[model samples]
Target: MSTNYPKPAVRRLKVYAFDPQASVTLATAMANDYVIELPWEQRWEAPLEKGPVNDYVEVIDIDPAAGLFYAPVDLDDAWLRDGGLEPSEGRPQFHQQMVFAVVMRTIRAFERALGRVVLWARDERLSSAELPPGAIERNFTRRLRIYPHALREANAYYSPDKRALLFGYFKPPESAADVQASWVFTCLSQDVIAHETTHAILHGMRQRSIDPSHVDARAFHEGFADIVALLQHFSMAPVVRQLLAASHGSLREPGLLTGLGEQFGRAIGRSKSLRYALEALGDRARTHQGSAESIAAAIAKLRETTEPHARGGFLVAAVFDAFVTIYERRSEDLLRLARPGLVPGNGLSPDLVERLTQEAAKAADQVLRMCVRALDYLPPIGMTFGEYLRAIITADTDLVRDDPLHYRVAFVEAFKRWGITVPGCISMAPDSLLWDSPRPEEYPALIARANGTPEGETPPQARMDPDDALAWWFADMLKRLQFDVAFDQADDGLGERSAESEEQASSCKVTYTRRDYRSGPAGGRNLRDLAMRVVTHNQRAIHQWLEQCTTDRHDWERLLGVKLTPACARVADVNAPAALRSISGGTDPDAVPNVEVHSARISRRTGPDGSEMHMLIAQIVQRRRAYFDPEEQKAADSGDKGAIGALRWKSPDFWFRGGATLHIDLRDGRLLRVLRKRIDDDARLARERAFRSGDMIAATAAVTGNPREPFAFIHRGS
Candidate 1:
């Protein structure tokens, strides 16, 4: 291979600004086309294959319902590479291009926020017993498969079981307006593509969150995806500017930016978009411009909504309300400067519109970043809207010590108005909701164990505090990761290029690159791939370390909320794997509860004031089998260990999980915080049981057994 081989840093593709319907309207037609510049990396020496397949995602344009295989568009083609195929509903290739572009764009947003490459959820079929001895390598997914036309219905979803995104198409109803096309393709909608992609990204971060543990569990997933898709609209400056001009700088007005799935929503017999953020306020307040009374009314309704999408709408509205608040604050000066006494319905000057657009984009970007960063701070499983509020507050406060613009305050107030409140918080203050930091005195047993001594025995490392010991362990594990994979500097494939680069190769633009790879290895590899390889290779060692330090320690159990020792026997008829099941019919002397180290990654975030905070984030989860019957669960929750142990003889109804997310600062090797959900908490267990046996379950009883693919049914006709 030639050392000087050149590849463009980005491939710009034209996609619909919103959906196909936006292109037909005179108001939005001029701005309906958008050019998405995808970060390009040349993995192979030759040009990309027809599928436009890359490391992150693969676009397989097969219309199985139509019984036809559409050839994938070659994005590497000279003409298409220059400006991409024009946006067209009739063209299958364009559908492929649009989905790829929007999906990649969404992926890039998450990567930027996370400060690390995004990995998809692992393959669900892999079992521990099937693996050979000492082989910790489970099948981690490489590419998220995309089928542009997988079904002949009005739906699209990210399937965790299959590790693929299936988009559908359907004919519009006769009552549907603006019916120029014969069929509506979900793949052609930017909102749908981004929303589904967000689901995949979120699933990668929190695997067990897909379990409907509470009303907010699945609802959080839906609302969060919509939030990402809606906020992404502001990133398109031209679209925002055009909409702002039309609405006279009032984002409160109904428009394409706030409504999702414009074409599909109308086709499904809706008057406007499929679902608008403003509608969360109820019919009377959709046009109320987010008044205090209107938002409170919306909050009251949130308690009554149980459907995933409908309940998720409240979360979306809360986040959108925060964005709008931030935007208004950010653009207040611009509006004042444009005109001292600007009227509500008056048109703004073009320059003022441009300035307002920048402000809106900036606000949206900041809010989106806050939402994404909060994912790291969240508990590994059983997420709630109230918990998400705390995550957003804590995550942002950690990065930006002084919130001069009051970004954290905006989020708190918005969530508070929507009736979202942390369960134990005394007040809605930001500091009151932050996750408690770890204390040295609280982990005496863990510290003693870490020093290689028994509970009271003083060892050589007795001077080391709990924080220092934890930091040391985390640092040691990260050292084993060997993040510095070697790469040839001359090879553009291995170098880090900015996502904003859009110039063609002929322009001879000197693409600025960062040296993320070091000089010690022979092969070029992706950072995420290298990290996963190292972690998986040493999975057993890591698991053993965590289990040994935490097992039988009351302090550790309190801190992490997982039961590690005194493993109860496997329940009868439980569908768990052998490795996950306890060995005996009662308390097992030889068995330790299964401990899974899901992911450990480095987070390097920079504050606005040029301060850098680098830390390691890792999650640990453990599962326990339990019955769904309230009486059985109550007996198990009793203080008697005998009763808890005896329940193992009966058939288990479900697997209950407890987990913790660890945030450790690298500067001084100090433990920052541990966010957890307790495994043995009777209240939580009761809530989960109720949710499982509640109206939500009865509504979806037809799809009860197929929990692995929750998105498949939830996204139908959505």
Candidate 2:
């Protein structure tokens, strides 16, 4: 149990310069010390059930061969005492450290892109965006568990059920032709670890994406994981420079950045990597941006492939292609900057190489954020490649209105090359696919209510200062909500003090402080926090009202299993305004215009194939659970007296039991349709009956010692 104690903070760690593949061909192969601010430790044998002992990561080398948590590199004299010259030279301790470092690095990247904390699905309390009682929240699965040697095969996976990353080590190919070595450890490979961690992080954000109901669902998982790993390669300045120096600015040429999991591929006796860069499509295969017909042809060819990897690879290729295009364009300017006037045709200067590398790195960083942030704009379920393209466009459009460099245009061109077209677009123009903001006239009540005036009274002059303006606006909104609240600036009587006097004083005097109190459930919370709560409450109320109207109009009957209730029937708020704010460049929440929650109440709808149905279409349909399963009570009642660390079987963690699609008319505030998730009773009964009959036959055969087929007696009579 002492081993479960928190590990000391890691100031710096020397890890592999890159993956083993990059080390083989790049000059930047020297192990570099990476700074990790959080604490981490290795728990060789013990496993943690929930809370992490450390802040960073908890490495659980589940393999029996993984002896005591001995990480020599953690000590100051590791390089002098132990022969720790090269961390990448296949040491068990180094492998454990590398896996932990890479996983944390990947987590940080996602956090940076979202501009907020990255919450894992296992963090039950902060499951949704709702803030908890403590103004500040810590990670539930604080230190992500890593199984460095979980299996003996060339496979690695992120287990959502366990909330741990399982990495495998495989024996090299037996054939003499395969010269890589005896063992291929996936944890050692940066790409492999990064890829697996990305899967975990993405699932944390969107759990529904794991359901492979649609083709894009699984492919998105694989492709997005690869993209994160691929972008990480560009993140390291040294790695980019080495690759640029080797290829002489021709990124299309075979290099470390062009291929993924090189060491693993070679060990398996493969000529190429698991995946190659899209630039390898060849100069002849490249589709010009202007050639729409040609791009369409390429897309048609890609669509012919149904396999997840193949389709996913195509998407990776498409995005990578855009990165390459941007890199090339940005590098041209750098090339000229390296050598003023006409650039030399001969070898380039060292300064130019560094400049060019920086440009490429910058461009990749932007593209990476664009890809990750786009996830917020995507649908909850049933996404297509084209829909992803639309998400990218809309997400970028919301953040940056003026794209003078036409970075978005370049992405549109790249997507077009692969024949990835936006669904329901009026034209091929990039703006056509971008998500539209609500018209100003849509939500008049929000402004009317927050106007800081009674029904028959005239409003006072607005505050000119931005902070004062927001404070005033927030107060007004609270008043409109019928909440009894008061706000006043508590100006400290103390005025200007000499610099020496201020320094002599223990603490500085408070110049300004706003005191606010509300007579409601949100009383003790911060005033701004309460304002947000009010806004959120109002938004959900509107949605629930619309839903109630629709259900009343339809006169819906009760289902077989569900117990209806006022709270259970209430529709969930999809947090459209927050999502919009993510892309919206507005600094002041008060200054931002009221969000228009648009919806359509259609009597009938028809598909392009000519099929028609009477229904309503919502602006945005969110996936919600029909009910919660009482798993904790079931476990307690089962008389399982095991502690948190006990290895007991747990029932499935289905966050949502049953699913339903609520169609709302956002414009008119109406819930038009309810498409509930259906279960086939006939299929369920047949399968259960077959299982029971087989069990009975198996029991009889076991007792009689007769190796007979299940239900053979019944067949004999026939």
Off by over 4 Å in 2: 1-10, 21-53, 64-85, 123-140, 175-178, 284-290, 336-346, 439-718
lDDT for every model?
0.75, 0.52
What does candidate 2's lDDT look like per residue over 14-75, in tens digits? 45544565454435344233333322323211221221213445676557554444443343
- lDDT for each residue of candidate 1 in 1-718, tens digit (9 for 90 to 100): 7789676778889999999888887878987878998766643212345887776888998887778999889987878876699988898999998998999899999988988778888765664445532232356676799999999998899998898999999999988866556898899999999999999999888878788778898899999999999999999998888889888888776679889989888888787888898654443335543467755675678888889998888888889888888898999888778776666667898889999999999999999999999999998979899999999989998888998888888888778767676778898898998989977667777667667777678765455766776565566554444333333224356555443342322222121123224323443333455445444534433454554433545665676666556443223212222122333221133333466667666788898898888887877776655577666555544423466555553445677777788887776667789888876576787788777778454346345646677888888776
Q: Compute the lDDT of residue 56 as modeled in candidate 1.
A: 81
Q: Using Cα atoms with residue i matched to residue i, what is each candidate's TM-score against the true structure?
A: 0.85, 0.60
